[model samples]
Target chain A: MEVTEDIIREVEKGNRKITLDLYHYSFNVLMSSAVRYKNHKEDQMEIVNNAFVKIVKNIKTYRPGTAYFSWIKTIVKRELIDDFRKNKKYKELFKIRDSDSVQESVVEPEVYESMDSESALQMLNVLPPATKLVFNLYAIEGYKSKEIVEELNISYETVKWHIKQARKKLKSLIIENKISLKQ
Target chain B: MKEEKDHIDDFFKERSEQSSFEVPDSFLDDINSKLDVLDQKKKRRGGFFWLWTLIPIGLIMMYVLWPEDIEINKTKPIVSLENQETNAEGALMDSMDEQKSESILISDSLTEENITQEKPLNDTENRSAEKLKSLKNVLQDDVKKIDKLADENNPLWLKEEIKKQEVFNSSNSNNESEIVPPEVEEMAIADSNPEKNIETRNSNINATENAEIEGSETDFAIDENVNNVVVSVDSLGNSESEDSIINNEAFEIDSVQIDSLPTETEDQDSTLNVEEVDPSETMLAGGNREKGDKINHEIQLYGGVLNSSSNLILSNDSSTFPMNTMESNLWSASFGVMYRAKIKQLDLGAGLSWMKTGEKANYGTNTLEMAEVDSLIFIGWQTDSVFNQNTETWSIDSIPLYDTTTVTTYTNDSIFYNTANKYTWISIPLRFGYRIDVNEFSFIPRVGIDLSFATGSNTGTYAEIINEGLTQNSSSRFILSYALQLEVRRSFDRWHVFVNPYFRTNVTPVISSAIQIRRYNSWGINAGIGFKLK
Candidate 1:
């Protein structure tokens, strides 16, 4: 199940059992990509399944010397973007819209101290698809506004708006969840 | 805990933490199972590829071998007419030769009862002469009533003469006796056979008997002059009495025919005799150029294989599907060659075709932000389902000040997703249309209903191939469609090369519901040759 030259070769040859084994072994390595690009309310399991199918389909085109996990991550990102682009929910996210004073809700780091990473992910899942994507890109992936605009094909201001909205939604989710925990 | 106000930007910049969520237990198994199912489809399509070749070829061979005009040519003798006959005597000899070999049935009648051949026609003796004289006297008396043989050039006159000569030769073998009786001999043959007149009377009695008699023996006696008695059997007289029937041969033998009539049974008698059977119009039904010419009907058979071009109406107004669809080379082909007849300038025809056709389009609901929305955009897809937004207010008084806040709830409206819509239809088309052959090509525009009995894919207005594989559309539906068929034909002897372009449209929608309606319209061209099996 190790990501090796022979394993990659067998997967490329369309050995179904080997493909399944490789998928199981590489689950943890691929999970982050699936989570990062996953849209709000979309099933992470379904995304993983779609990503695995695409991986197997493109196995023949995979370069042996290249980083296998990166290749898989790239496919996962594409699948998520495609999933968002195809749906009617998030198509307008990158378009030019009114850039005005957004309602901002900021929280202190002390609130996140007691919060588990699982809780953080669940909170991130509540943001609208474009806002979530922009937040992941700007905060986690560390892409600048211009890079985000070029990569996501969005106006610079739209990306900033998404970042702001994402923070507000994340703050709200954290506050609501913390209150619920206290209750 | 007292909350500290920090910019949302600082909160985002502060975190670079990994998230942990438990993946589903059977997640790997689910992907593998789906992969297996999708893989099976690829295999099945591959398997059908070879069948595509063999199936159409087998169908073409079957169509080529089917009997189209076979029955028309069966009765014509294999022997050449020139070799068989030179003059009137030779013609009689030919008819006699046919009758001798065929042993045509004249069942339970005159020759069946009274005219017993003590010996064959070869037995030219005194007793045979006496018998012939007696039979001749009786036959002439009956035939005397049919005196229309007054014209020597007439075909009926010749039938009458041949009948008398055969009777004479059966009675005695003399070359001079063969030449002697022209009209008188026919009168003798016609008049002498009282039982033949009686049998004719019986066939005349009913419509059923008329069909039976035509089936039994409707041979219009062909003479040496090739003059044929086109039997006006009803003209002969349907009366039960022999006297009235005898009187009716006044319209005597008007039509002419030589090919053997297809009777159900044959008489065992080896002598050549005119079969006195019923009368119906059997002139044209027999297969031959001669029989065909008399009827004024010509058969035109065409066989062609065509590839069709069709499209799926993905959206009501081509929003998802623009005029130029990013299409692959996915098309369908059909082979069906029909038979048409030229009735002067107008041609009428019908044909059966085996068609495997489909319409495919990839349609997705692109996220449409009415005003570039970031807040959960809630709006109805249509006019009717407007979401009811209800608001309630709560107020909290702090530091001797009162503040009010509003909470609004919005209804859920359905959103569209990206779907790869694909539908495959296998239909059997039964088409009837009018064809016009101008110069080398014929245009046949047909209107008929096609039965789409087997299919797979999306059942909506169009098939949507979503990010998730193809939608299952398995149920069969009837589609009304029309075809503007163009054919280029080159005929060689009895064979021809037919290239028909099959263009068809569905008048009815491929998928229709209360909200949406879609149609499968296509234009395709197929090229193949076919044979005429006559």
Candidate 2:
């Protein structure tokens, strides 16, 4: 379902019915941002639902004619960051590990090309917590090393190293599986 | 290798854009439940917020509308008597020395009607005035005895004075008369015996000296009481006979004129000019009063130069350098206006400032090598023929054997240049300051955070590698900093001049550009003037 201005207006006017419709429509976008960092589906759902509640509460701050998806994505990212800061267990995941170097052999292009997004995501999930987050930000979210440095307060070399490590692990995961039938 | 990396990044970026995972059916239900709880909490919080906000406002309104009549009779009457002692010729001697003592005698019947029109007494004030009236009667009786004693022709005055004291004692025992001031009672007792009157007068002088030492508050009260009696007489019509002075105009106090009769003479005609005393000034004359108002708000304008210390991050990759400018000097400057509102001893303030930090710096020297092309080299010797004008025959003379050849020589030179690099920031500082005052000077210490935004910037020359066509790029547009400040202020009436010395440092780098990252911590002294707003 597409979100119309009428539905947005209804949600802003405290209509719970239209709010549910808006939630279902924007669910996939919210989940996409929440899914990368959280390991459990329940925690991912929590971050998305909290972000949705914030969007509904502060709906008046939403400027018209701007990209609604970008705004929603920003909120979801902020919710993820807040979760990271509050949860002390995330500190263990953020510790920089002495990762092995990338192998000399590169994975053939056909293997990556034939890979389904579900399998690709599974391959990406196998990377270390920090490496997975850095790769998602650098490749999927299109963030520069400098922006990642500012966001994570990490060194430029650390961000570059994580990206390299994530690529190496994902390539190895793909080579181990070779080509699999689409589920 | 770069292309291979780009390929995987492109694939993931596309996948992330095109793919959407299935959301569980219960996700929407969960959001609805949270939304309902949030709505309930918001409603409760909104109600509480209004309730809390209106309470103080309601209290303030009630206080503002309350009546002023509750403050009735709070201030006492202000009065000062210039006692006039008249001689036999009736010339009034306007000297305090001529008066017998500083002790004031209150009239026995100074009621609401007996007061002057300028100061009308309420019913409560009149009750206290009437109590003072009873004391006046005792003083009046004593004045009569003194007047009778002044008759030196009566050689039997001593016997008559004794007989009157006995009568006064009998009246005091019978009617229970109002208590007279101790000094007045002593005067009456001393005058009864003419032989020891001089010795008793010396004792009264000693008592006056004791009153002065005790403090001025007592002196002010006694002076005002005595002036009230004179004012009461003046309120009525001035007359020669004691009866006319008592029975003249608006109100009558019994025997009020008898107290004035000692100074009254037949030839005296000048009426006393009543001096109105200010109660507030009289209280200050005691020198023991609290200050009336404290300054609650102030706005100051200040500006100064500072010495800055900064760490610069430079990159070696000259191709993709974001910022082309770097500052070599450490001098910076800033100026701004601030407004402070005091809550008791602590003050909270916010200010807007413009701070400039970077300066022109030398980029580097550029050396260029060029080949010098114009050179003649000797290769081999050759004969040259020359003809003499007089010989008419061809003659060959060897001037010099030379051949033209190309030779390359290198020239080395360097060109030096500097670029103007400046960074301007519009900053807002929120601070908590405490003021300590000593005499006319005050020292205030402040600590707070500063939030700044880079509004303007220009590129400067830096290092040996110069990238052409690259503009200045600010790494971070916003920066948070902290500062410590101490203000030394000298007050002059409503306006004050102050010198504020401060130290500030950015929590994050203000400019985190690719080539050069600059973060500045500076110390500065600012001087300016401020006015008391309230």
Once model 1 is optimally superposed onto the true structure by TM-score, how far is the C-alpha of residue B165 displaced, in angstroms? 16
How would you encode candidate 1's per-residue C-alpha lDDT over B1-534 as one tens digit per residue? 112223444344343235434556678568868788768876787788668646645664554565544442232321111111112322222222222211212111123112333344444555554554555345434333223232233355345545654665454444534554454454333333533422332222222223333322232232223233332112112122110101122232323222232232322111222243222222211112242222112223333333333444444543332422533323554555444444444444444455554443444423222222223322323223333345344444322222222233333333343433445555545555565676655565555555554343335333233222223343236666766665566666556566556667777766553323555566666565544444
Tell me the spans in candidate 1 whose CA falls farther than 4 Å from its real position. A1-15, A37-42, A54-75, A78-130, A137-159, A165-183, B1-24, B40-55, B65-534
TM-scores of the first chain across all predictions?
0.78, 0.86
DockQ class, candidate 2: acceptable
lDDT of 2 by residue, B458-533 (tens): 3334443343322344436678889999999999987899999999987888666555566777788888988766
Clashing pairs in 2: B107-B133, B108-B133, B108-B134, B109-B133, B325-B460
The runs of at least 3 residues in candidate 2 whose Cα sits more than 4 Å from the true structure, single-residue gaps closed, are A1-22, A53-61, A85-114, A176-183, B21-63, B73-534
Q: After superposition, how far is residue B507 of candidate 2 from its true place, in Å?
A: 19
Q: How well does candidate 1 score on lDDT at residue B221?
A: 31
